[model samples]
Target: MTMTPSLPSFDLQIDRADLLEMERDVWNNASVPARLKIEDNMYDVYIRYRGSYTRALEKKSYHVEFEKPGIWNGASEVHLNAELFDPSHFRNKLSLDFIRDLGIHTPNSQHILLTRNGEPLGLYLQLESVDDTYLCKRNLPPGTIYYAVSDKANFSIKRKRGLTSGYQRKLGNMQDDHQLIHFIRSINTSPHEIPRLLNIENYLRWLAGAVCTMNNDGFTHNYALYLNSEDHLFSIIPWDYDATFGRKVNGDVMEYDYVSITGKTKNKLTTQLMKRSGYRRRYKGILEEILETKFNKNYLEDKVMDLHSSLRPYILMDPHIHSDIDSYDREPSFIFQFIEDRKAFLRRELKKL
Candidate 1:
């Protein structure tokens, strides 16, 4: 016998025109008006497919933008993650939970029972989308330069390669690429000078977070960089975490200490910064603090178990389980084992510092 956990509900209503378009195989960049009802209240949302991998799924993830906004608990938009990768349907949840606990600039999320036009679409992770409103909600300056980077040259001398090639500008009014060019130049030319152009503590925490979670995809892509208008520094924000917690992009399995857990990254700036004596020490200290505090295996195990227990009953109700419901049902304990093992391995690995 198992008990299901309580979660929020979203009954989504998309018009037939949009529904028809969405059902097609090439619905990657399509959008439709969606009427979403949370309890008796309703909000008009512009819904569209928004992900590289998840775009190819039968049950896909979505980006929901509110046409009108006042900020509902700091969220101006939302994403419905289909949890296509992990059968336990908890990897993204666990990752977000870890990020929030680390006290970083990350989108808040929760498990929610989703219904499509009165029928169950299955369990989805309803995540708050990180955008301009996210900055405002945290009382951060609205003029921050935000980039949704999805390519290589990730924080490198992108200006040297081509200003238009590396990342997409989400906000801010840049007269030209000079600001980003200068930032990249500073990072490449003077690593010690980063404190003038970036927030050291924020950078340290972000690098530490990726290492702790073993987010293999986070270094160059799968991340958002915000040049804080107030502080005039760049900070990393986490995104797309189903590939973490013992998994790699090439289908390789990750063990504890799977990654270097240092600032050394494909991104030139991160690699250069980590080479510095002071930055390396600070990064090591942050890792130690994480291992001692929030990333403690026992604490994480409790969360994994709780998520699995609550979702067990609902997972049974899910029509799409990749292989079978039984295999899916057993994934919690498997991932839980990963969490415990990863922590143990890191402890032994980080004991040097």
Candidate 2:
């Protein structure tokens, strides 16, 4: 007899209100000392707390990082919230994991579950913090940075325009010919002995192909690229996967094109990306390969189910995923309008190439 791996189990029917409440409880009661502290960095939430038995002895909590603050506090280990619960999001993580497992330079991560008051609240996948060393080690231009904007955080490109400094400067700008050249130049340089530009381009095209095949909403803000001091550039690891798996708009799959904002204006990067024959050709292959994968459907479905099973019980009592459902719903008209405008913008820009 052969033994099959037992699938992970979770609850998907929980309301959003319960999830939020649980999040609050965990925020309040996790074993952090009173002297421990938390600070919001605008980009991410940071927490300073008492180290665990293992961490205390090592005095290395300073080196320890979690994807989301306190996400690991009450759990046996830290993990990302999306990977443990949200089905669509989890599938995205699995896709990324598959990519990394296949030798891609994706950020490292592992699944984790969070509980509070002796009850399961939710799940998260903890990610290895990609240090500034990874960025600085590469030789990049003076002003190179990366960012990711998500619906949950309202960190879209449009929203980022008002922000200043760090990664924000990279946003809020339309793509132009000169900017395109600079972007290409930055990535093409040899950073830390790595073929920074080529690898970054390859990954972008690859991601585009994957997004199309999976019917994922690959918004420009959802992806990023970074430059290091070594004059090298690399693709920032991807995040957020809750809106994938055959999700479509207007009978057409949602394709992420950073070049166009609502199909009207072209981002500087998009113009350059379209001009690259190598990127276009590779994108074609990526889409084809994604569709051709032997277990594509099964893989996706199983991933969703696995995530559902792992988070169901805990999510049931949490309010974030279920209770406040109305808060999560976006007006379809607005999204469609943006898509239509962006498509038109891309069409015009593509013709320039």
Candidate 3:
């Protein structure tokens, strides 16, 4: 085996063990403000337990926020994604790269080796958090309303859960919900009004990315919706792709284009939009274009191989907390097989449209 090329890495050290202990307590499921140092630079941060059930695991994903500006490349916070599901640990990174290649606005991420109290914790995927800082970095105007969709966020007129729990507020006040609520109602009831209230092109591209990658959990949840203050319309952004490529969120193998022929999602608003022949055809066209240009199997395989080779050394030394590392090689190979099989499956399915 050869040594992999060096990439940007972060070495983290925290001041308080008690705060970390609180974070690790599954029952507490809480966050504590603490001082953290990354590569000798210190900052104020809130370390919080994140993810639905992933919090229960020994290796838990984290929501980390830095209060000061210019903490890290102009980022206020980043998601420390604990890749607990697949041993290969490149599923989320690979999927993000694929989506970005397709021109969808997904979070930028990199592999980071983390440590606490100078001891190696394990490999973590550091992802840009989607919030005001994210919007500012993109040159998007301020006061943009950001809503994080989850499994329960069906965009239904009838409320299933609390009005607040379904969608998370990132940038603006709770009053901003009126616009989104009205928009969701309009989507379900007055389907024809969609083209006026939403950024259809961006949503379609994101949907296309999800379909090509077989992200079963992406549509209803694992996505962000941003309301461009200027136009008052919404845009969809991809999130939490750890279950992408070949499997559903629950670790089930899924067929490519698992949701719909034209890449329509399980999202209620998305379903309503796909009812139109024009949108359906447009989705087919978008998916075809992605398959031809960005989602190339050879390109993806090369990318995956580079990642596999690069991470091989780290994987050998990784004290991974929850996953079965014995299957590391097998998992990456399965992902490769998924790309080839998914590409073929999508090609065949695209022809049906």
Candidate 4:
């Protein structure tokens, strides 16, 4: 893999014991003073660079946009992963790039490498800070709601038991789907410059395509939904890509399982989502076109291969940690599973449509 001139040499040289101690120190006391502060009607926002279990050595931002950023961003906001895992393989930057290339909605980001003692320590993807002031000032219509996690919020509750446990909790809750459908219905009822329902469908299809492409760790607590004053709803912009691009180990090969698209209830909800007439008739073609154009197996293969190449050396130097990275493979069956299962659900739902 060709290395970018800007990227520093991949030379991580700390023993397992030393690494653990360092990790503890960093997690225990790794916070910086807030540069800017903003207050929206119901929330106080603070932004700070921090670390996480998923990406042990890196620094990323915590945005506290609400009193609580859900169960994930809890008071113990900064901590080391109980286990080590590779950060998203520059996944945020890659996802932003891939999404923009395919014409999807994403916040802007730039790549920066965080260092300690003037030596490269980890990579950070700096994103454009978005606050509710901007959302309110934009003049969104009544009943349109915008949601985000405040920096002080604890999202860890959702993931308390582990990744799967967190996902199950989210799936069992009707509130997510209820809120989502409510937004859709609001769009359907409201008068807007754009065809609101069509926009919603387009976003869903785009999100599905993104899942197929990256085999991403799909929407958990961090996904944000944005609604304009005009009652036009946009898809939730993806955040936290540290576990994307087929890099996860110990998972099923099926794309549906690659993320959290499992369980009978989620299956039913997914079926209902895809079965919507607007999604089935008007948006499926566009989704198919985009998938064919931007997210074929070859595309995913090339991208993953490139990422593996870039990160391979760093990973190899640490056998224990790198072994986890080596475990993931490009399984075509994953994509097929997603298509087949979603197709079956859609077919059943379409009969009613």
Best by TM-score: 3
Q: TM per model?
A: 0.89, 0.47, 0.90, 0.51
- State residue 294's C-alpha deviation in candidate 4, in Å: 1.6
**Tens-digit lDDT string for candidate 1 (1-353):** 55455677888899887888877754557568888877677888888887776677777787887765534556777888888677667887788778868778787778788888998888898887667877877787765545555655366754445643556777766653566667777787766677788777877787778777788778777777777666667777788787777776533466756676562357676787767878777877878888888886567878887887788777777777634578667776667677677767767866554
Q: What pairs collide in candidate 1?
A: 5-310
Count clashing residue pairs in model 3: 0
Top lDDT: which candidate number? 3
Which model is ahead, 1 or 4, in terms of TM-score? 1
Instruction: List lDDT for all candidates, in order.
Output: 0.73, 0.38, 0.75, 0.40
Worst 10 residues of 4 by lDDT: 34-43
lDDT of 2 by residue, 1-353 (tens): 43333323222222455435434543232332111121212112223322122222211122223334443333222223333223232445655665554334454554544333334444445444333433333332343445444322122223333322123323224432233234434433422223334354545544543343342444444444444334444455554443443334222334435323222122323334445676555554444454345224444445545554554444444444555334223223233344344434444544443
Candidate 4: C-alpha lDDT: 0.40
Model 4 Cα lDDT, one tens digit per residue, 243-329: 444445323233333443221223222344454565455555654555556555455556645654555565444334445553433
List all candidate RMSDs to the true structure: 2.7, 12.4, 2.6, 10.8
Which is superior by lDDT, 1 or 3?
A: 3
Candidate 4 matches the true fold with a TM-score of: 0.51
Task: Sort all candidates by TM-score, best to worst.
Answer: 3, 1, 4, 2
Q: In candidate 3, which residue ranges exceed 4 Å CA deviation?
A: 1-3, 7-17, 20-24, 27-29, 68-70, 159-165, 250-252, 255-258, 262-265, 321-326
Ten contiguous residues with the weakest lDDT in model 2: 34-43
Could you tell me the lDDT of residue 328 within candidate 2? 22
